[model samples]
Target chain A: MTTTSTKGQRLPQTSKRSAKAAASDKRPDEDASAGARRRQIMQEAARLFGTRGFEATTIRDIAAATGILGGSIYYHFASKEDIFVAVHGAGMEKITQAVLAAIEGVEDPWDRLEAAAVAHCNDLLGSSEVPVIVSPYYSESLKGLRETLVAQRDRYETVVADLVEALDLPPDVDRSLFRLNFLGALNWMPTWYRPSARLSPADIGRQLVQGLRPR
Target chain B: MTTTSTKGQRLPQTSKRSAKAAASDKRPDEDASAGARRRQIMQEAARLFGTRGFEATTIRDIAAATGILGGSIYYHFASKEDIFVAVHGAGMEKITQAVLAAIEGVEDPWDRLEAAAVAHCNDLLGSSEVPVIVSPYYSESLKGLRETLVAQRDRYETVVADLVEALDLPPDVDRSLFRLNFLGALNWMPTWYRPSARLSPADIGRQLVQGLRPR
Candidate 1:
């Protein structure tokens, strides 16, 4: 019933396996500029990964996209998996912050849920990174990255869990199932949504609430 | 906002590029047994494609899995993409039949929608093939298969469109968006649903109704 309400298997709670090169391991001079540069690298890498998929995409491809040399790209991260991990983290952070901001100060649980759904759909539609984190379709092929991604997902789902907990529903309703179904719909948006389409993300979000809300 | 509600780009409506070997072109001798063999091949291929991606899965892998030699696979399927299209067709047929059967006697829009939703979730959770057609996450890389797949998707979405069309809702409610959100949630079950979990497909389906139904 938790965010980990998965079919028997799930992502790791905490993977100590370092996907990144430590400051002590590779760079002793890591600082604010380094952090910002890492963010920039992650943004482009996430986009390419989303577009090209995991296997077809290469570190060299990411480097070219970022206008940096392939070898230099590794200086920011240990490997392709490392960059993916960072992208995963960045995508989760972006969507999470957006959802959190949307739901803030909304007293009604349904309203908050709708707002969260809207923010989520809008973010996924607007940002490639959010969809990357949401689907992780490519990650299935990358076994080493699975645990790290799952751990990050658990963090993201906790935010959703809190929102679901706020809903005032019948005592008999299964809250876990509610959240699962709710999120499945929310996450599946990237596959079908279009800006040219009639429904905006917010409109779609509200309709979800209307469709699900008891008549 | 119909089933073709895609993100700017989508598959072709009618691909004159036939995936199947035409009667005059190659398989003129195809009989009932050949038809059964094609079905068997598609079932096994769909499962393999679902587990390993289309790119990673080879024709030989499918042939071995089906207990046939690699060369024999082509007797029924022209290529891997051909097998994929057939699987897509079969998966669609199975779910469509199940959903059509479930909603046959149902009349009320709310009840019919719930029936369709339950049938869909059950179909998805019960059959590995259903999820194959539903997500086809690997299709992103197969540029040639994209249009064909999208066309198949349009067919599937039509069923959903019919169900949404029957719904009695407010004028302000965007029916297309409602169904899109509803379907998004329904289609996402396979990623997390476990038989060992508490909710049965029908139970989960009912919960979707309860969550979405107006209070």
Candidate 2:
């Protein structure tokens, strides 16, 4: 009975374990292959969704992209929407984690927000395998999935919202609008951002924050 | 020869004529029906493209949505891509004209930009038949169509670019980033904007511009 309780506690504590350590503890070779296969599906699905969009991409296409059998994909994800949600959630998690880490020791509200933006822009525009997948516009076909996607993204938004709330701004300024507009600028960078552009992602973030800093 | 010269000169002046006047000047019934059919096709296609996306939305789908035969669509557009280009170009034209009209008498650089943003946000968030179709991100599938889309949008970007150039920004500021980021915020509104929200589109626009105004 004591061992069962200890095991239950240990299961929830997996978050503290390094991903590799946790995987290795599972089933060694089998775990490694499954993990690698799952990652390949995710990466390929993200790429396909990024280029072809959610509706246009199919399980078959994802399987083909990852060089796996179509039937094998169902073993990983229940449906195409499930894979999309996973991709979106993963991207959001990466961004949220980066922003949280970036602002960990920062004290000043503006500075904290700036650090978050820098981390965000870098993760989003940088060569991360799972880049933040905020679309330029919301698609009508994704209407049903929007709620799920929005909920997933809300965690990151809340982090930024907290940072914005801490700012000493003019009383008339709407903090919500300020937060949205600030993030909008950062998220929209992928539309016009070029690798060869004069400004780096960090530069873009700083410039954007600088533009919004109240006199 | 003199008559031919006068007719050629008059033909180029059609820009000054009202669209209704120009339509009536053509074969009245045939031109009117043809013009209505084209407008219907454009409106329906824009909605389909907005909802279903460009690749998924076929000429047959557009024809069905417009209540015309699939074969009849070729009378208005050469292909699905041609229709996409037309919708994009039309949206750009509407936005460009609105911004131009909005800034006609405004002289202050900031004020002109504010007016442009107001017009832009209003049209983008408003019930305009052909809203600006800037995607949330550049899709990989759009690689082939990107140049055409960018060419269509450049006319409007140049208008905003010129406005940003005129601003009395600090010497360290990159005006191009300022312009892109400014438009980025305005363009991103559709993602989070709610009609039921407290702020109207114009109010949102004013707030965005106010947020960016250099202290």
State the DockQ of every prediction: 0.39, 0.45
Candidate 2 TM-score for chain A: 0.86
Give the per-residue lDDT of model 2 (tens digit) for A11-105.
Answer: 32432233355477757886566656766788899888777777777778898899977767665566677777777888999999999999999
C-alpha-based local distance difference test score of model 1:
0.70
Tens digits of per-residue lDDT, candidate 2, B129-202, equal: 76667776545656788888889888999999999999888898888899989988988888888889999989
Report the TM-score of chain B alone for all candidates.
Answer: 0.79, 0.85
Which one wins on lDDT?
2
Give me the displacement of residue A170 in model 2, in angstroms: 1.1
Interface RMSD of 1: 2.8
Candidate 1's C-alpha runs over 4 A off are A1-37, A128-131, A136-140, B1-33, B128-131, B136-138
True contacts kept of each: 0.53, 0.66
Question: What's the residue-level lDDT of A159 in candidate 1?
Answer: 93
> By summed lDDT, which 10 consecutive residues of candidate 1 chain B come out lowest?
B1-10
